[model samples]
Target: MRTGRPRQFDRDEAVRQAMHLFWENGYDATSLSQLKAAIGRGITAPSFYAAFGSKEKLYKETVACYLHSHGRVTDALWDDTLPPRQAIETTLLRSARMQCETGHPKGCMVALGVMSANSEEHRHLLAPLDTARARTREGFIRCVKRGVENGELHAGASPDTLGLVFNSFLFGISTLARDGVPLSIIETSVRQIMALWETFSVKNGNELPNG
Candidate 1:
């Protein structure tokens, strides 16, 4: 008699399901049972261990997956080709649209992870999220610096402060999105936020840092 083959499951789908669960309930709340249940075809404990090694490992995988996919929306921030204003606006509007989309979970996983970072385990697991956020903030800062260099934003405008404002707003948007705020309203709010940048025009650009 020929030896029988062990049943196989879709690992990619498993990570996707795990991503949604983590995004919905956060890091510490999601249980092993939940992960097993969420994964398609229902994997056994042995198979689960064999497939993922452990929950922490699986969480790392899911986070990486999230970054490569949904997280790319913010990548517009780093696009040097886009004008400074357009780059910032694109990231804001695109992030809002993604957070409010019908499919998958609402809100950004990275932002959600940051907010739910209460436990040490979460903090450790959230290294990638932290890096991603820092990258986003850096992107904003780069845009402001570029704007200054090109005379688009005038001179002596503090890049750090300007970048923080948008970064703070971007994270706040995740909270609003998770709170059921509609996309259209958020989009309008983004435009209003951009108007704040316009106020920092070349007219008052050379103002001191205290201003």
Candidate 2:
């Protein structure tokens, strides 16, 4: 008897499943067999190829899914209505909480993406993640500049340097989260980190509280 079309599945759900595997294992580390198993037992090699074209294509799709979803926590850094300091604090707190939250992989895909493929041959595959990291770093610098422009920070504050302080801390959060550090501790540390910026803050042409 002639075979009928294979039963269909939820593409979004498949992608989400694949994304978690990639998040936890990294691209180079995760294999086609693992992806097929994670996506669903029914997804044979041919079906997998038909659905996603190739492993590289599927990996790129997962990256897009990640950026659109879990990666959005830092978007607070780009919000203009909140005071620059508040924006920075919100981004840090949000990202920390998210990286530590249940129901998803610990840590950030963007932060861990680089570790996915260390070999030069696969390095180009992670360009999107590299660009995302750069964008977040730029967001920090932009927020610092906004603070300085509005006198929220002292005139002597260096946006490049100050932003690096926050950016570096933000990047480190992923490692801490992955290492099973408690969210509460990270949050407490965030407060201290914010205080570091407060030391340079000003209000009404005078040194701000904690300055």
TM-score of each model, paired residue for residue: 0.91, 0.93
User: RMSD to native for every prediction?
Assistant: 2.4, 2.7
lDDT against the true structure, per candidate, is 0.87, 0.90
Q: Candidate 1, residues 1-211: lDDT per residue as tens digits?
A: 9754474778998999999999988888899999998887577888888889999999999999999999999998989899998999999999999999987899999889865557865578899998999999999999888888887785777899898999999989988998999899999999999986776667554444357
Local accuracy of candidate 2 as per-residue lDDT tens digits, 1-211: 9774674778899999999999999988999999998886557887898889999899999999999999999898899998888999999999999999998899999998879988898888899999999999999999999999987888888899889999999999999999999999999999999987877877645554432
- Stretches of model 1 off by over 4 angstroms after superposition: 1-5, 115-117, 203-210
Q: State the lDDT at 150 in candidate 2.
A: 89
Candidate topping TM-score: 2
What does candidate 1 score on TM?
A: 0.91
Model 1 clash pairs are none
Q: After superposition, how far is residue 95 of candidate 1 from its true place, in Å?
A: 0.5
